[model samples]
Target chain A: MKVRVHVTLKDGVLDPQGKAIHRALETLGFAGVRDARQGKVIDLELACADEAGAREQVDRMCRQLLANTVIEDYTVEFV
Target chain B: MKVRVHVTLKDGVLDPQGKAIHRALETLGFAGVRDARQGKVIDLELACADEAGAREQVDRMCRQLLANTVIEDYTVEFV
Candidate 1:
Protein backbone atom coordinates (compact mmCIF):
# COMPACT_ATOMS: atom_id res chain seq x y z
CA MET A 1 0.00 0.00 0.00
CA LYS A 2 0.98 3.60 -0.52
CA VAL A 3 0.53 6.23 2.18
CA ARG A 4 1.03 9.98 2.33
CA VAL A 5 1.62 12.02 5.44
CA HIS A 6 1.37 15.78 5.55
CA VAL A 7 3.07 17.51 8.43
CA THR A 8 2.53 21.20 9.04
CA LEU A 9 3.30 23.74 11.70
CA LYS A 10 0.25 24.92 13.60
CA ASP A 11 -0.91 28.50 13.42
CA GLY A 12 1.21 31.15 15.22
CA VAL A 13 4.45 29.22 14.94
CA LEU A 14 7.39 31.19 13.61
CA ASP A 15 8.78 29.92 10.32
CA PRO A 16 11.90 31.72 9.16
CA GLN A 17 12.34 29.44 6.17
CA GLY A 18 8.86 30.19 4.90
CA LYS A 19 9.53 33.87 5.34
CA ALA A 20 12.70 33.62 3.30
CA ILE A 21 10.83 31.89 0.50
CA HIS A 22 8.14 34.54 0.54
CA ARG A 23 10.71 37.30 0.18
CA ALA A 24 12.32 35.44 -2.69
CA LEU A 25 8.95 35.15 -4.40
CA GLU A 26 8.36 38.89 -4.11
CA THR A 27 11.69 39.57 -5.75
CA LEU A 28 10.65 37.26 -8.57
CA GLY A 29 7.76 39.72 -9.24
CA PHE A 30 5.03 37.76 -7.53
CA ALA A 31 3.17 40.76 -6.21
CA GLY A 32 0.44 40.79 -3.60
CA VAL A 33 1.73 37.70 -1.89
CA ARG A 34 0.98 38.45 1.75
CA ASP A 35 2.33 35.44 3.63
CA ALA A 36 3.79 32.03 3.15
CA ARG A 37 3.93 28.81 5.13
CA GLN A 38 5.87 25.66 4.38
CA GLY A 39 5.18 22.01 5.09
CA LYS A 40 6.33 18.54 4.18
CA VAL A 41 4.73 15.64 2.37
CA ILE A 42 6.01 12.19 3.20
CA ASP A 43 5.21 9.48 0.69
CA LEU A 44 5.65 5.93 1.77
CA GLU A 45 5.23 2.47 0.36
CA LEU A 46 4.51 0.01 3.14
CA ALA A 47 3.93 -3.73 3.23
CA CYS A 48 0.71 -3.53 5.19
CA ALA A 49 -1.76 -6.39 5.15
CA ASP A 50 -4.74 -4.03 5.06
CA GLU A 51 -5.78 -0.39 5.12
CA ALA A 52 -6.86 -0.34 8.75
CA GLY A 53 -3.56 -1.68 9.94
CA ALA A 54 -1.70 0.77 7.78
CA ARG A 55 -3.61 3.73 9.11
CA GLU A 56 -2.99 2.68 12.68
CA GLN A 57 0.68 2.15 12.08
CA VAL A 58 1.15 5.41 10.22
CA ASP A 59 -0.68 7.34 12.92
CA ARG A 60 1.59 5.96 15.56
CA MET A 61 4.58 6.77 13.40
CA CYS A 62 3.45 10.35 13.09
CA ARG A 63 3.02 10.79 16.80
CA GLN A 64 6.22 9.13 17.82
CA LEU A 65 8.64 10.79 15.44
CA LEU A 66 7.43 11.86 11.99
CA ALA A 67 5.69 14.93 13.42
CA ASN A 68 6.40 17.18 16.35
CA THR A 69 2.97 17.21 17.98
CA VAL A 70 3.82 20.12 20.25
CA ILE A 71 3.89 22.51 17.32
CA GLU A 72 2.85 20.45 14.32
CA ASP A 73 -0.02 18.22 13.22
CA TYR A 74 -0.24 15.54 10.60
CA THR A 75 -2.80 13.86 8.37
CA VAL A 76 -2.47 10.48 6.73
CA GLU A 77 -3.80 9.22 3.42
CA PHE A 78 -3.71 5.66 2.09
CA VAL A 79 -3.65 4.54 -1.52
CA MET B 1 -6.87 34.33 -1.95
CA LYS B 2 -4.85 31.43 -0.68
CA VAL B 3 -2.78 29.21 -2.90
CA ARG B 4 -0.83 26.02 -2.38
CA VAL B 5 2.10 24.78 -4.43
CA HIS B 6 3.46 21.28 -4.11
CA VAL B 7 6.95 20.57 -5.41
CA THR B 8 8.50 17.14 -5.65
CA LEU B 9 11.52 15.42 -7.13
CA LYS B 10 10.76 13.30 -10.15
CA ASP B 11 10.73 9.55 -9.92
CA GLY B 12 14.16 7.78 -9.78
CA VAL B 13 15.82 10.86 -8.28
CA LEU B 14 17.99 10.00 -5.29
CA ASP B 15 16.63 11.51 -2.07
CA PRO B 16 19.19 11.05 0.65
CA GLN B 17 17.20 13.04 3.20
CA GLY B 18 14.15 10.88 2.66
CA LYS B 19 16.26 7.79 2.95
CA ALA B 20 17.71 9.00 6.24
CA ILE B 21 14.24 9.67 7.60
CA HIS B 22 13.12 6.23 6.50
CA ARG B 23 16.01 4.68 8.39
CA ALA B 24 15.10 6.67 11.48
CA LEU B 25 11.53 5.46 11.22
CA GLU B 26 12.74 1.89 11.09
CA THR B 27 14.86 2.42 14.17
CA LEU B 28 11.76 3.73 15.89
CA GLY B 29 10.12 0.38 15.17
CA PHE B 30 8.01 1.32 12.19
CA ALA B 31 7.94 -2.08 10.55
CA GLY B 32 7.00 -2.84 6.98
CA VAL B 33 7.89 0.62 5.74
CA ARG B 34 9.38 -0.04 2.34
CA ASP B 35 10.23 3.34 0.83
CA ALA B 36 9.87 7.03 1.51
CA ARG B 37 9.89 10.14 -0.66
CA GLN B 38 9.79 13.72 0.52
CA GLY B 39 8.20 16.82 -0.96
CA LYS B 40 7.38 20.37 0.00
CA VAL B 41 4.17 22.34 0.21
CA ILE B 42 4.21 26.11 -0.15
CA ASP B 43 1.16 27.94 1.14
CA LEU B 44 0.62 31.57 0.26
CA GLU B 45 -1.93 34.19 1.19
CA LEU B 46 -2.17 36.70 -1.61
CA ALA B 47 -4.14 39.85 -2.32
CA CYS B 48 -5.02 38.84 -5.84
CA ALA B 49 -7.79 40.69 -7.67
CA ASP B 50 -8.75 37.44 -9.37
CA GLU B 51 -7.89 33.78 -9.35
CA ALA B 52 -6.67 33.71 -12.92
CA GLY B 53 -4.04 36.39 -12.28
CA ALA B 54 -2.92 34.56 -9.16
CA ARG B 55 -2.52 31.34 -11.08
CA GLU B 56 -0.53 32.98 -13.80
CA GLN B 57 1.77 34.76 -11.38
CA VAL B 58 2.30 31.63 -9.33
CA ASP B 59 2.97 29.58 -12.41
CA ARG B 60 5.70 31.97 -13.40
CA MET B 61 7.11 31.89 -9.91
CA CYS B 62 7.25 28.12 -10.03
CA ARG B 63 8.93 28.12 -13.37
CA GLN B 64 11.49 30.81 -12.60
CA LEU B 65 12.41 30.06 -9.02
CA LEU B 66 9.96 28.35 -6.68
CA ALA B 67 10.76 24.93 -8.13
CA ASN B 68 13.65 23.48 -10.05
CA THR B 69 11.90 22.28 -13.18
CA VAL B 70 15.02 20.36 -14.15
CA ILE B 71 14.42 17.86 -11.35
CA GLU B 72 11.05 18.84 -9.90
CA ASP B 73 7.45 19.43 -10.92
CA TYR B 74 4.80 21.47 -9.18
CA THR B 75 1.04 21.73 -8.91
CA VAL B 76 -0.81 24.81 -7.79
CA GLU B 77 -4.15 25.03 -6.03
CA PHE B 78 -6.18 28.15 -5.28
CA VAL B 79 -8.50 28.54 -2.35
Candidate 2:
Protein backbone atom coordinates (compact mmCIF):
# COMPACT_ATOMS: atom_id res chain seq x y z
CA MET A 1 0.00 0.00 0.00
CA LYS A 2 1.02 3.57 -0.64
CA VAL A 3 0.52 6.38 1.81
CA ARG A 4 1.09 10.10 1.61
CA VAL A 5 1.60 12.49 4.48
CA HIS A 6 1.28 16.24 4.19
CA VAL A 7 2.95 18.33 6.87
CA THR A 8 2.25 22.00 7.07
CA LEU A 9 3.06 24.82 9.44
CA LYS A 10 0.42 25.73 11.94
CA ASP A 11 -1.52 28.96 11.73
CA GLY A 12 0.34 32.09 12.88
CA VAL A 13 3.72 30.46 12.52
CA LEU A 14 6.34 32.51 10.71
CA ASP A 15 7.44 30.88 7.48
CA PRO A 16 10.43 32.66 6.03
CA GLN A 17 10.82 30.10 3.28
CA GLY A 18 7.27 30.60 2.16
CA LYS A 19 7.73 34.33 2.19
CA ALA A 20 10.89 34.01 0.13
CA ILE A 21 9.10 31.86 -2.42
CA HIS A 22 6.26 34.31 -2.63
CA ARG A 23 8.69 37.13 -3.27
CA ALA A 24 10.45 35.11 -5.93
CA LEU A 25 7.15 34.44 -7.65
CA GLU A 26 6.35 38.14 -7.66
CA THR A 27 9.76 38.96 -9.08
CA LEU A 28 9.11 36.41 -11.82
CA GLY A 29 5.99 38.39 -12.86
CA PHE A 30 3.43 36.23 -11.03
CA ALA A 31 1.95 39.20 -9.21
CA GLY A 32 -1.46 37.59 -8.82
CA VAL A 33 -0.07 35.34 -6.09
CA ARG A 34 -1.15 36.81 -2.82
CA ASP A 35 0.51 34.48 -0.33
CA ALA A 36 2.44 31.23 -0.22
CA ARG A 37 2.94 28.62 2.50
CA GLN A 38 5.40 25.81 2.09
CA GLY A 39 5.03 22.32 3.51
CA LYS A 40 6.32 18.77 3.21
CA VAL A 41 4.99 15.65 1.51
CA ILE A 42 6.20 12.22 2.51
CA ASP A 43 5.31 9.27 0.29
CA LEU A 44 5.64 5.84 1.80
CA GLU A 45 5.39 2.32 0.46
CA LEU A 46 4.24 0.15 3.30
CA ALA A 47 4.56 -3.60 3.53
CA CYS A 48 1.50 -3.82 5.71
CA ALA A 49 -1.50 -5.89 4.75
CA ASP A 50 -4.23 -3.49 5.76
CA GLU A 51 -4.86 0.16 5.15
CA ALA A 52 -5.97 0.67 8.73
CA GLY A 53 -2.70 -0.70 10.06
CA ALA A 54 -0.67 1.38 7.65
CA ARG A 55 -2.49 4.53 8.58
CA GLU A 56 -1.96 3.89 12.26
CA GLN A 57 1.73 3.21 11.78
CA VAL A 58 2.27 6.27 9.63
CA ASP A 59 0.36 8.41 12.09
CA ARG A 60 2.73 7.31 14.81
CA MET A 61 5.65 8.05 12.53
CA CYS A 62 4.36 11.55 12.03
CA ARG A 63 3.85 12.24 15.69
CA GLN A 64 7.18 10.78 16.61
CA LEU A 65 9.61 11.93 13.92
CA LEU A 66 7.95 13.25 10.77
CA ALA A 67 6.47 16.39 12.28
CA ASN A 68 7.15 19.06 14.83
CA THR A 69 3.72 18.95 16.45
CA VAL A 70 4.36 22.17 18.35
CA ILE A 71 4.40 24.18 15.13
CA GLU A 72 3.12 21.92 12.37
CA ASP A 73 0.06 19.83 11.41
CA TYR A 74 -0.03 16.68 9.34
CA THR A 75 -2.61 14.70 7.36
CA VAL A 76 -2.43 11.15 6.09
CA GLU A 77 -3.86 9.88 2.80
CA PHE A 78 -4.10 6.32 1.51
CA VAL A 79 -3.43 5.98 -2.19
CA MET B 1 -8.65 30.99 -4.96
CA LYS B 2 -6.18 28.49 -3.51
CA VAL B 3 -3.64 26.35 -5.29
CA ARG B 4 -1.25 23.64 -4.11
CA VAL B 5 1.95 22.48 -5.74
CA HIS B 6 3.66 19.21 -4.85
CA VAL B 7 7.31 18.96 -5.84
CA THR B 8 9.05 15.59 -5.78
CA LEU B 9 12.39 14.23 -6.82
CA LYS B 10 12.36 12.39 -10.11
CA ASP B 11 12.88 8.66 -10.24
CA GLY B 12 16.50 7.49 -10.06
CA VAL B 13 17.49 10.67 -8.28
CA LEU B 14 19.23 10.09 -4.96
CA ASP B 15 17.47 11.75 -2.07
CA PRO B 16 19.70 11.96 0.95
CA GLN B 17 17.07 13.66 2.98
CA GLY B 18 14.56 10.90 2.26
CA LYS B 19 17.11 8.28 3.19
CA ALA B 20 17.83 10.01 6.46
CA ILE B 21 14.12 10.21 7.19
CA HIS B 22 13.65 6.51 6.43
CA ARG B 23 16.46 5.60 8.74
CA ALA B 24 15.01 7.71 11.47
CA LEU B 25 11.64 5.99 11.07
CA GLU B 26 13.26 2.59 11.33
CA THR B 27 15.08 3.63 14.46
CA LEU B 28 11.78 4.81 15.82
CA GLY B 29 10.31 1.29 15.25
CA PHE B 30 8.35 1.74 12.01
CA ALA B 31 9.60 -1.45 10.45
CA GLY B 32 6.68 -1.89 8.05
CA VAL B 33 7.79 1.11 6.05
CA ARG B 34 9.47 -0.25 2.93
CA ASP B 35 10.48 2.94 1.18
CA ALA B 36 10.02 6.64 1.72
CA ARG B 37 10.22 9.69 -0.52
CA GLN B 38 10.07 13.29 0.59
CA GLY B 39 8.76 16.27 -1.34
CA LYS B 40 7.59 19.83 -0.94
CA VAL B 41 4.16 21.40 -0.97
CA ILE B 42 3.59 25.03 -1.77
CA ASP B 43 0.15 26.37 -0.91
CA LEU B 44 -0.77 29.59 -2.67
CA GLU B 45 -3.62 32.00 -2.11
CA LEU B 46 -4.17 33.66 -5.43
CA ALA B 47 -5.78 37.01 -6.18
CA CYS B 48 -7.04 35.71 -9.50
CA ALA B 49 -10.71 35.82 -10.42
CA ASP B 50 -10.94 32.34 -11.97
CA GLU B 51 -9.67 28.89 -11.18
CA ALA B 52 -8.21 28.54 -14.67
CA GLY B 53 -6.16 31.67 -14.23
CA ALA B 54 -4.96 30.64 -10.80
CA ARG B 55 -3.83 27.27 -12.06
CA GLU B 56 -1.94 28.75 -14.97
CA GLN B 57 -0.19 31.31 -12.78
CA VAL B 58 0.77 28.79 -10.14
CA ASP B 59 2.00 26.40 -12.83
CA ARG B 60 4.31 29.12 -14.05
CA MET B 61 5.45 29.68 -10.49
CA CYS B 62 6.40 26.02 -10.26
CA ARG B 63 8.33 26.02 -13.51
CA GLN B 64 10.17 29.19 -12.62
CA LEU B 65 11.02 28.83 -8.92
CA LEU B 66 9.00 26.28 -6.97
CA ALA B 67 10.53 23.25 -8.64
CA ASN B 68 13.76 22.27 -10.35
CA THR B 69 12.74 20.65 -13.63
CA VAL B 70 16.13 18.99 -14.01
CA ILE B 71 15.57 16.42 -11.25
CA GLU B 72 12.14 17.12 -9.88
CA ASP B 73 8.49 16.85 -10.89
CA TYR B 74 5.66 19.06 -9.70
CA THR B 75 1.88 18.74 -9.70
CA VAL B 76 -0.51 21.61 -9.15
CA GLU B 77 -3.94 21.31 -7.51
CA PHE B 78 -6.73 23.84 -7.18
CA VAL B 79 -8.83 24.05 -4.08
TM-score of 2: 0.97
* Residue A44 of model 2, lDDT score: 89
> Can you write out model 2's per-residue Cα lDDT over A1-79, one digit (the tens) per residue?
9899999999999999999998988888887878899999999898998888888888899999999999999999988
**After superposition, which runs of candidate 2 have C-alpha atoms over 4 Å from their true positions?**
none
Kindly list the per-residue Cα lDDT of model 2 for residues B1-79, writing each as its tens digit.
8888999999999998899999999998888888999999989998898877777777777788889999999998887
DockQ of 2: 0.93
Find the number of clashing residue pairs for candidate 2.
Answer: 0
Candidate 2 at B18: error in angstroms? 0.8
Positional deviation of residue A69's Cα in model 1 after best superposition, in angstroms: 0.9
Q: After aligning candidate 2 to the native by TM-score, how far in Å is the CA of B38 from where it should be?
A: 0.5
